[model samples]
Target chain A: MRAVGAEEVAPTSHPWEIQADGLVVRVGGRRGRNAVNELTLRLGRGVHGLLGPNGAGKTTLIRTLATVQKPSAGSLSLLGTPLGRATGLRPLRRRLGYLPQHFGYYKRFTVREFVEYLAWLKEMPPEAIPGAVQRALEKVGLADRADDRLKTLSGGMVRRAGIAQAIVNDPEVLLLDEPTVGLDPAQRLSFRELVAELGQQACVLISTHLVEDVAAACTDVVLVSEGSLVFQGTPAELAAAGTTDHVGDSPIERGYTALLSAGPGRSGW
Target chain B: MTAHHPGEQLLRQYVRGDDVPADQLWAVEAHLESCAPCRGRLAPDPIAEQVWADLAPVLDRTPQMPPARSWLRHVSHWVSPVAGPWLAMILLVTAVAVALDQAGSVARGQISLVLLVAPVLPVLGVAASWGRAMDPAHELTAATPRAGLPLVFRRTVAVLAVVVPGLLVASQLTGASLTQWMLPCLAFTTCTLALGGLIGITRAAITLIAGWAAGIVLPTIALSRTSVALDVAATPVWAAVLAAGLIVIAVRFRTQSRSS
Candidate 1:
């Protein structure tokens, strides 16, 4: 596949593509303990891999970005629109695509129907949907299987269908939580290429435990643990933080281990 | 290259981020993917560049032939996968009630079972329409822009579409006054949605069904007398309850969207 040239243009009209200031998300109740506590980050157009151990609040952060969960305290703004206001949410949602960790599907729905339904939900122009759905399914390598019922698909195919729906709108911001969980090696490679293509213009945040995926596809990395940001930098930068004593086969994996052990206060980025 | 290139007017409109017709845009994009000269002719506007950036990769590949069109594709938005079975079940229940009434079960002045059960059937359908536990795609559906009360209402409408007609037919056959059953039926459905905003839809349906059975159905059966709740004289009360339930649902929708 050909690589599309990156655009060089004027500064964006929006001040920040995605801005989070002292974002605190509580899991259970108003007084419930924090799931994501006092986490602050700013992201612009690129592929960002969100990494952490299990129960590290990665999913919480992804959910908050996806607007599936409201922030209990602090603020979040996407594409220059504040999430707190109800009026701005629909428009923001129009440009947002999210694939949750436990992605759900209507088992009886064919692949084409599933993606088309999501395109409608994202408020795509009805006329533009057919072409867009065609493009999205092709991009995810599911065009041939578009008519197959979701229940008939294998686990990896279902994940690809999830991706097809996410990209059908040509979303400005895409949040994918554990999107690669079911894919084999070849599919993972194609996914990396897809991410690279999407990242050229959109802000793509992927929450996963795979350091290799982050190393291969992500332009930037954010490490979170216990609902707090531990590190933020390029894969090379993360790899540089690793020491000989750290565990894992790859530098990115070692860096991840090293950083988590170094804990909250010692983020090098 | 052919001299028959797209006009400057078209290029300008495309660059200005105007809503170019979809076919025109598709043709232009397909051409631009190969013709770097034409791509260069386009202005350096960031938004246009971004649109092209997103479109170029898609234009390069050959999409597989779309499958044969299915009827489910058209109506799947409002009606869920489980709706057909639920509707069939409702019809079956209605048929059984009609048969029982035809056999003179109500000759002794007892209320018909169909009349007793009709009020909550749609409520059960609405409950089955959408829920976290019921839909396999619930989380994915919830994340979409169209998720929430609007989607819920659409599914409810689908449920009612199946249910109301069946009940109307049953009422005609069993000689039950349409007002006597329709009012309570609508009231129960709206109330289930209203209460569903607090508890879940499934729970709300169960609670309302149980309440209706205990408070009205069981007593009517035991006493072998018509229940005041289903009488035509109680139409005003049922209408009032329906209105209140609608109000509650509207308010709850606002709160739910805001919180989410």
Candidate 2:
């Protein structure tokens, strides 16, 4: 028999919105001590809400999307650029905004200095720094606190500053991890409006287990479970996917619980 | 009359993730599959041309032949931090060595302490270069990609480029000829910096301290013998060999960290 040699295969295509046919991630912790599997993401616009229990790879997926963590297998692209192929990520970073779950801010820096520094890192020209910093502060409703040092800001205000740095670049794609984590009700409402404003311009993906924020901010919902997408639909669809008896007015809390219990691919929420 | 694009509604539905009837989703997908402009937006821009353009200027700007003496001048400028203190210490030590050597030379001390202290310059020169190389800020700075390859290499090369001339000039000022020791001194200084950078700033400090003790103390001990061959300038080839080994390890460690 004629030897059948290695077959050529075409590469999978990735869109700005995720087109991940299959994605797998295995990451070793700093000293290669621990490994965790993170979810695979495909690209698209609008706010995609991520919901899962703790240690379910919600943060992991967000980090992977931000290009801080590499997937063990499968492909991903953000704003149309393949992760590895792009050598200098500065330009991509300029277009990609992120509010990590936690970040260290220089306590001595005034709000303006911190935001201006991030803008400089994004290579925003000297002239645009002031305007960008002000616009970001205004968007986050922190305009009054612009002159205050980070050490002087309240907990909620500090969280808002984190958000202000994130969107200062006006990135094409934005990922906010637990944006409402430490916010009071009033601050959460204000943050929601800012997210809505940003959604008008870029892809805004918010990962949080808190269904209320998802209900308030997201137009689309992505339920991740056990490192895989369990449901990808709108809030209404997600609610409808819950038990038929409570379908119509099913609250996000009830729907989110239903989705997780039904397990991966069941989509019962 | 307002114009209504047929695809506009589907686009809105798509963004909202609405459960559009299957027919509409299929039609939009079919249209997108064949549309080149739409498809191109979904793919990453090719970067080969951009990489070429960015690198071209840097390569072009590099000098074909820098002034032969420029490297010496650069080294002199760099060794200032350690050289300043070392020169003061050496002046004090040199006076002592000269007095001791003169007295010893007159007596059974045919080998002067001046001759024993000759090895001091190269050892101190290398130590100075390595000390500057191991600056704690440089280690933390290296951890960030912002410093990039060129910046890291430039800083490392900058240290090396500065130390050599400093050695040459200091030797000239002292009215000493480095006919045989020239290459070894150069190798020692360059290698120490390379090693210091490789093992990290802290480790490099420890290595420099150990090297200093061995350089001065060991040479004095060896020259204490009546044998004229044991003078500082006449260090066994093994000392140079050990310095070379340390330099190689330093270079290897530096390159490994850079790559990592």
Candidate 3:
């Protein structure tokens, strides 16, 4: 007879860390048109880049997965628990990390303090918090500026600090929306390396318009257009889907434009 | 004295994150900068690797680490940034109202200025406590598990803790009985939160404040008599409103939690 084991049920080994089935999220309160229209996705422990054009509901989808907004219809489950139910949310929340597209920081807070405060909110263990905060800051290359106030930092540095806070808990499900907006090329390169490392253990989902960032760091790419899945495949497959007829600088971008044009509801007002 | 090399022993200590003498650390890092083979000889330690990836462990050990966050910092985390100034403003308003009453600026022979504004003061404070405009991080705060009611209640209580004390002082000084405005003050606060569930806390607070100004304050000032809303005999009515507001709040939270 086999005894129950925590290892067997640990989230890393879980088949899919995030599962969504025909999910719908309405924006602008009730009676609003769906921002994320019937988004269906399954993600496991790996880096999956979410690529979409502007106003394609990428932020709304990321917000829903972060458990910030409730699904107006259908279902969403993270690390195996259904998001709709009223049970065990606190526990689930403790294991999640999110960086909003426009995360605000107290001007007076040092970079370390900001991450530490978020780690506390994420309900990290008190004893583990200090070390976890350190590791996260180091991971994002912000350890040198840890003691500096947020107001003193540059825009790119602030974005890196935001990334540190998001990873402080070593979260099972990490959601980042438009995380590379202010990053310089050198900063973006290191950010890609950090993301590649994080994807090895956790389900790291980054929603962005930068196809190059995803192609460099992501193991899998999921494309959405107008709140619907246009393509879900590896970077190689995405590159293979495109032809010279498509307008782009690279194979991946050409593929993205190709599939997006071919997908239903393309450029329809 | 190996000027070009600090030797393998000192390099090992540095790589293992063991405390090497400061002089040797400087010397070895300097030597490794110019000596390629010496740098290649060091074994990797995971902790030391992270600290010395691009630079050396010296960068991690900054002499002046910022002081640890204090207990007061923790308190402020739950409270909104606007709570302090908003509460101060409430006190200043209360003080002004008290002065108005002392200066014989009563709305009527029976109506005190302190009693007139006390009920709406907390309502205004509630708005400051929860307004997205007031909090720059509202989007991030709303996304957290502790975001919805728990966080809202924390800010609400912080507002009340300040406003209630100020109102008590104002009532005592103005010779207005606490019973006249105390229930209405709390009732308006709860009602703001209740209606907040439908059309945001800030909007609800504004609507309630506007309604109070238009419906009660205007009529009371125009007629030079106490409105029925502020009379002591309407304690039961205020009590009912407070209870109804609390019930709606509870129901709203329940539905919100289940859906979210």
Worst 10 residues of 3 chain A by lDDT: A1-10
lDDT (10s digit) by residue, model 2, range B76-159 = 333432344555555566566656654555346644444344444444544443332533222212212233323333433444
Candidate 2 - CAPRI tier?
Answer: incorrect
In model 3, what is chain B's TM-score? 0.71
Q: Decide which is better by lDDT, 1 or 2.
A: 1
- Name model 3 segments beyond 4 Å from true: A1-14, A29-31, A265-269, B1-67, B106-110, B250-260
True contacts kept of each: 0.51, 0.00, 0.36
Residue pairs that clash (backbone atoms under 3 angstroms), model 1? A104-B137, A105-B137
Q: How do the residues A1-269 of candidate 2 rate in per-residue lDDT, one tens digit apiece? A: 12222321323243555445466766564454212233445657777788777877777677776766666666667665666543445455556777777665656567776676566545565555666778888898888888778789988888888888888877768888888988999888888888888887678889897887888889899887777777778898777666754433446767777778778756433
Candidate 2 residue B176 C-alpha distance from true site, Å: 14
What lDDT score is found at residue B90 in candidate 2? 51
| Residues B1-260 of candidate 3: C-alpha lDDT, one tens digit per residue | 35567656776788878998888888777877787777677656688778667665655575333445676456666667647788888999999988877887665446677888988998888888776788776666665667667778887888888889998988888777787888999999999999988888989988999999999988888888888878789899999999999999999788767765
Q: How should the candidates be ordered by DockQ, best one leading?
A: 1, 3, 2
**Candidate 1 ranges beyond 4 A from true positions:** A1-12, A29-32, A265-269, B1-70, B104-109, B198-200, B249-260
lDDT of model 1, residue B258: 74
